[model samples]
Target: MNHELSLDLVQSSVLAGVLLILGEFARRRVGFLQRFSIPGPVIGGFLFALLLLVLRQADVATVEFDTTLQEPAMIAFFTTVGLTGSLSLVRKGGRLLIVYLLACWTLAVVQNLVGIGLAEVLGVNPLLGIMAGAVSLEGGHGAAAAFGPTAEAMGAEGATAVAVASATFGLVAGSVLGGPLAGWLMKRGKVRVPTLVTASTGSTTTVVDQGSDTGSDSGSDTGRGPETENAEESGSAGYRKLLSTGVLVGVIMVLGTLLGTWFSDTTGFVLPGYVGAMVVAVVFRNLNDRFGWVRLDSGTVDLISGLTLGFFLTMAMMSLKIWELYALALPLVVILAVQVLVLVVFVAFVVFRLLGGNYDAATMAAGMMGHGLGGTPNAMANMDAFNSRFGVRSERAFLVVPLAGAVLIDLVGLPWIVWCMNWVG
Candidate 1:
């Protein structure tokens, strides 16, 4: 009854790939999964975790995985995120981008404070509260996996599992509530979606003329900034492009690991390796943008990001020891529930008004709920669903939400959360 099965690094990595494929397959087949934007990896990985939980409870063999590649994959994905954060894009977003970014940063701080405060009241580790807070909610599964080990090292038991679970809750909660919140705001304000006109040239062209007070067309330029130039560089064959990107990412990861190790040793402070990699990547990205030193392609970077994030997330989810969270379960539920309530209130009252309180603001509010409680993808899904229903796309919402949620928000949120962790530890 004590049998154990251990998988080596290669086997574990392959299994993670299979799980990713399985998740994608299920998503393709399941309509609700697509509607909710539930990630394939999460679907597959969580199912596996559930199976493991049942097997363990039934006294069946327990399996162990070697997640040696998980860290590297995580760092690579963050590095790609760093590469996307161009100063020019931020500038293009103008005043509204600054406001939205500030809102997201504020949310991270609020989430942590509320989480830690409720944790003390609930008689649970404050660090576990942090795990359930921004680390899981705003940070999503990626941040949960990255910071789980840090929390565990700082004496929080089952931090990874708890954070992962909290993130999953946020993903679903954000998806379910975002559109409704936006819809309610729009209905109350009598915000009307701008008419979308279709012009038929040689090819059919659709134009969005958003001249209504429902949204501000301040920074409505839909160009992707540096990505537009980079897309041309991606004209090479797919395999060659991927290989080149891999090499560049590998080199950056190495440098980042070294830089993080050095910083930690010198300052006696813990700096996650991904942080260093992201910093280096940001520098490289900006420098490349200004000088065009390397032919960096955005498409390839996105590809790498998708692949690494999928594999890393699957590995992290499948390895979760859910049984360890039983003692902290009640506190975790309370903290997550409160976090959801706070995000809803904040988006409805603060984020909507600040973003201009138009139809555009309503769409962006839906996006804020998406990324505020979940991740950027969830935010996009929320906005997309809202926009599709109204038959209008808020260019401003698409630009600001994805840019801030995915890149700029992390710039402020990460350091603040890290400081809180160090202080609590």
Candidate 2:
């Protein structure tokens, strides 16, 4: 008999940390992985998951993890994403964000249509097709899991299994595809990020080269190192900022809960749990930006957001149950192959053109592919990786991609899935 080892919440969190550390080491040494900018957590998480699968398969050991931290981590990470959106950034990226969001909704509609239409052609039940479509693909495991019971209730046998398997394929495929897609688009189009050029005619130009990771130079980098140093020296002030910002984030999350609950309860329009918190954070950020009510540093907020995102993804990926994917793999491959072809064409012809045929657009296209195929974390990893290697930080892509993929698409996508179910039923 195989030994069964079940970890509690604390142990699971620690394991996730270990996986991230190991993943980082692998990413540093792996040539192809480094060239593409694959995130450390993804590398580590997948490796750990595969290890679990292997152990279980061999009947040497079976491990169970308490995944209680996963959802809260996701919610917290997304809330930080909302914090990234100041009113100024919004004003600059508003049109692009809106357009990208609309494109996602359209894509969701198309995904369902393709899945359902092809399922009919193949003589599979259309209800089963819906599970394979946006539910599993664009929505990932969470959405698939959410819709699974409903589909089963509607008479689709083994709906949950099908959804989980399809989503697993999508997660891996999306991760592999995103970095390559963006790289290809940028290379083929000969797109390059615009470099800042100043006409230095006897004018003192202070050049501080901040590394590629943080995008543009901050105030400290612009010959203001003294001010930055002074700020750093003020230990009390730094502590106050940290405490205040932490408290504010907590307050915003609480407010978001109340607002999200009210929005869902009062109106029939249900939203994902994190959306409300994120929207509230956005409001707070914009308010702070405009009125200077509280000094919220963009750099600080970004640091916190990055931390949350890393931990969230680490915990989430470490809990992957891979063995369950094998049984439903065959049918999904054909269905998903068709889905991928559509994504390629759609991204090349439609998404690229409409968003703009520039480097930022290419990065955004890659991000869209990530979220469209996998989920939000995949999208972020793709964009982050592309940006890390190439220094193409499209603020518009960062703001729009997560909100659309994580929250906005779900609004219409879920309804559309159910409608397809009702139509077929």
Give a tens-digit lDDT track for model 2, residues 56-128. 8899898888868765655665566677655464345478877787888888899889888887887776777
List RMSD in Å for every model shown: 9.8, 8.2
Residue 50, candidate 1: how far off, in angstroms? Answer: 1.0
Which residue pairs collide in model 1, if any? 214-358, 214-359
List model 1 lDDT by residue over 1-425, tens digit each.
85699999999999999999999999889988887677888888888998999999999879999999999899999888888878788788998998999999999999999999999999988999899889988899889988998889989889999998998888889999999999999988888778789897687789987565655544358644444556656655777888998899888888988988999899877788898888788888889899998898788999999999999999988898999889988888888989988988998888889888898899999998888888888999999999999888999999999889998887778778887887787
User: Which parts of model 2 have CA positions greater than 4 angstroms off?
Assistant: 86-90, 94-105, 112-236, 259-270, 287-291, 352-425
Candidate achieving the largest lDDT:
1
Distance from true location, Cα of 154 in model 2, Å? 12
TM-score of each: 0.89, 0.66
Q: Which portions of model 1 show Cα errors greater than 4 Å?
A: 195-236
